[model samples]
Target: MLILWTQGDTNGIGSEVILKSFHRWRHRPHRAVVVGSYCMMKFYEKRLNLTTPLVEIESLNDIPMQEKTPDEPLYVLSLSCNIKANVGEIQADAGELSMKAVERAATLCLSGEADAMVTAPIHKEAIAKAGYPFQGHTDFLEHLSQSGRAQMLLCDIETNLKVALATVHIPLGKVSETLRASGLRPHLTALANALTKNFGIQTPRLAVLGLNPHASDNGVIGKEETEFLQPELALLKQDFCVDGLFAADGFFGAKRYKEFDAVLALYHDQGLIPFKMLAFETGVNMTTGLPIVRTSPDHGTAFDIAGKGIANEASFLSATHLAIQVAERRRHLETTA
Candidate 1:
């Protein structure tokens, strides 16, 4: 398997975490390449005093066509841009380079040049400053892949806790209207298919978190649960083994997430707040419903500790492992089919 990792932001801890994760993995079973500026990677390697050998390749075709060893040098498919790294600062040039890396990685994956992609943390504000209209990687990748719909799935490898968001990177004020307009059936169907195809769950048992406080307290607080959610869930039961509209607080507090194969949260924070609290170091964010495999560390660009050599790579490692697992599973299913 070959994985293409995108250099998130030259000004953030993206380079630090990528270098550290590769260094820590002594016995490599797969080939990995970084898609970004070679100069930026070299700068981090020297500044952090790491011994990982960096090799710059002209294109994806230049990658060595053989099994990689435990001590294999990291290959970088350097982009055309020449952005300088300014640690702990947000620069438009850095943002432009990071997004360019992402775009190239997506193209490689869709073209079958790469098996999977693992993205580093990218700053939302920086990308905006760069004049891109994307809110985050999920939407940007969706546009690149031209997928029907993209959903964000956060997973914890240690505990097998997986949560998928129905609505992502949207304002809280528009969540209700968006849900009503788009409907929940498509998101639920997509989540179920992703579990079966990506994670290899034969018959996934799923749960959903409510959009209202206390699940609307039986319509005492809000009508979303009774008016919209319940009706959709009732109709969806015939096609899926899903139960939900559970109050977010009690469901997670009581450890009910373990009972289901995966939980679907209506909005972003409804799922991420609890997920980050439980698996801050091990969380892996994956984009489902895309034609190609994609995963990233759940955390963001830590500018405060960008150049301090203290950023943890646990989550990035987890994301790498998950990407490999999913890619292999998809390949297996393809061959069998």
Candidate 2:
């Protein structure tokens, strides 16, 4: 249950959310550690007036392999980033710091030093400026884990909603072509696998949303559903209980989303906008089809609210809880299998 929490951008609310999360817990519930700048955490501790048992360690070897105490405190990996402690402004150094922390933490998970990972939000612009040019945490994780075809799954336990995106962090103009070129099979496969394994759904049924209005009205609006999706749907139906390139707005508006185990949205905004609308402060972002378990808060860096001591930690806390559950389930499944 050694969860490594990566400190995201120093310019945003990553550190604050993390600290605030620990503060909200009456008693520590998970064995978690941080993999980020020690100085930055200290600065936030002062600014946010939050305190936790922070055991700063140079490496994983410093930790004892035993059950953690209820008040075991949050251990930090303690990498020096020379953080400026500047809140609410993006910087190249903060970007580098965030990337370094994530890469190091992911390395631990890949190497079996950690059981699961909960990443704080990282700024795409800052990370790009720092020379780690990737779309976001998901892409960076794909590279680090060498896990091909990573899928982004967002969930809200309270709302009982799960959305898996086909294409993330891409322009709206390119979404159609991207989904068309990639085909729906991979997205379908990944979503189905995660639902079965992580969520323990024996026969998960999924709702597939269209890339066009009215699901293209049988090719009147767009051919993506007929030309690309139909063929794959024909093949996937043999193994999965999936149906529809349902029209997005109507499906969500009618609350048909609740009828399925999950929904597949063709693009980032398509999936996230509705998901966030329903569960803005409680959703968790999970990456499936990876060698290691990874989950994150649904929100971004939140620079506008950084250092205000008012950023909600519920989403980040939910992410941590889900990571622990998924990790345990994964281990149990491996043993049982």
Candidate 3:
């Protein structure tokens, strides 16, 4: 598979991790082409004291149609942008370059010119200043492809853990008022299909977390579980193997997630805190329910260690491998159909 990779914010450690990662995976099984500014990559490669051979190409068609050998070099589909960024300073030009790379790479995936895409960590505040009002890659890719639905799936394979958020990018105070059965039913349904298709589970077991404290503690603390969550779970039970209404706190504390294929949380932090805690450097953030495959490192752009050459590339490399597996599985599924 030919993977289209986009470097994220230059101010952060996105480029550093991307360079450090593929260099480590010198014997990569598949071909990948980086789709960001060439100058930025040159700077990071030099700063990180790396000598990964990269060939600059004008387009994906420019790559020779042949399997890359173990000793072969990687390709870089460098966007013709001369963006220069300070190591730890947010630069608008860096934001724009990353945004442009993302848009172009996603378009290639949508056009069937590329098999999949693995994006680097992007700085939300910097990208917003670049004039794209996206919350993150999930939102931008969903909009870019005009996808009907998008779900964020955070997975840690070593831990055998997966969590899908029902709501994302909203304030803590607005979570309760924003959730609804109408919206949640489809999200959960889509997530179930993802677990089955992507994870290859014949019967995917799922758990849904309650929104309130102690899952509302029989109405002592709250009733969203009684009035809202329970009803939705009942409706979802007909189509899913969901055993839900678990309190968020105790569920993770007791490690109940081990029994389920995936956990559906009502909001972001309710799911991510435990995920990050267990797989801080290894989690893979995947966007499900799109026609094309997309994945990213679970962590964000660490500005503190942007240019210190101390960034870990485990998550980024994991994301790339996952994208290849998903794309290949999807192709086989389609061909056999």
The top-ranked prediction according to TM-score is 1
Clashing pairs in 1: none
Q: Which candidate is the best by lDDT?
A: 1
Q: Which scores higher on lDDT, 2 or 3?
A: 2
Q: What TM-score would every model get versus the actual structure?
A: 0.98, 0.95, 0.96
Instruction: Report how far residue 272 has shifted in candidate 2, in Å.
Output: 0.2
Q: How many clashes in each structure?
A: 0, 0, 0
Better of 1 and 3 by TM-score: 1
The TM-score measured for candidate 3 stands at: 0.96
- Which pairs clash in model 3? none
Question: For model 3, how does the per-residue alpha-carbon lDDT over 70-172 read when each residue is reduced to its tens digit?
Answer: 7666678888656666888877777888888899999999999999999998887888888888998888989998988899999886897999998889898
lDDT for each residue of candidate 1 in 246-334, tens digit (9 for 90 to 100): 99999999999999999999998999999999999999999999999999999999999998899999999999999999999999989
* Models sorted by lDDT, best on top: 1, 2, 3
